[model samples]
Target: MRALVAAAIGLAAAFALILAVTAVGAPSGETSPEPLLTTVPGPKK
Candidate 1:
């Protein structure tokens, strides 16, 4: 039981470290995400 608890705690800590690293290392995006461009043919301009 003690070993199981330790293992669970270790796994949780590992996941937390991974989350932090990924969050820090991820590419930062613009404050505003890029807007999508749409194209529509006007009624024969």
Candidate 2:
């Protein structure tokens, strides 16, 4: 029972660490030159 609890806690901590690193490492929209998602212009009638 103790081992299972420990494993769960460890997994949670690792997931949190990964999420923090990814959030911090990613570039912000303002700093990036290109838009993250581009849309095509619609044809004029």
Candidate 3:
């Protein structure tokens, strides 16, 4: 259990670090985030 928890945390942190680096290290003239979050309203039954 402890090992599993540690591995989970490590993987999460690794992914987060990669994302942070890429987000900060993007080359010139490229954008990462979109202008808006997309959501659709469901139709009533």
For 1-45, candidate 3 gives per-residue lDDT tens digits of 999999999999999999999889857796768676587758889
All models: lDDT? 0.88, 0.89, 0.89
Q: How many times do residue backbones clash in model 2? A: 0
On residues 1-45, what C-alpha lDDT tens digit does candidate 1 reach at each position? 999999999999999999999888968675667766597647774
Q: What TM-scores do the predictions have?
A: 0.55, 0.55, 0.54
Worst 10 residues of 2 by lDDT: 28-37
Model 1 bad stretches (over 4 Å) = 26-45
- Summarize candidate 2's per-residue lDDT along 1-45 as a digit string, tens digits: 999999999999999999999888966565768767677869899
What TM-score quantifies how close candidate 1 is to the native fold? 0.55
Ranking by TM-score: 2, 1, 3
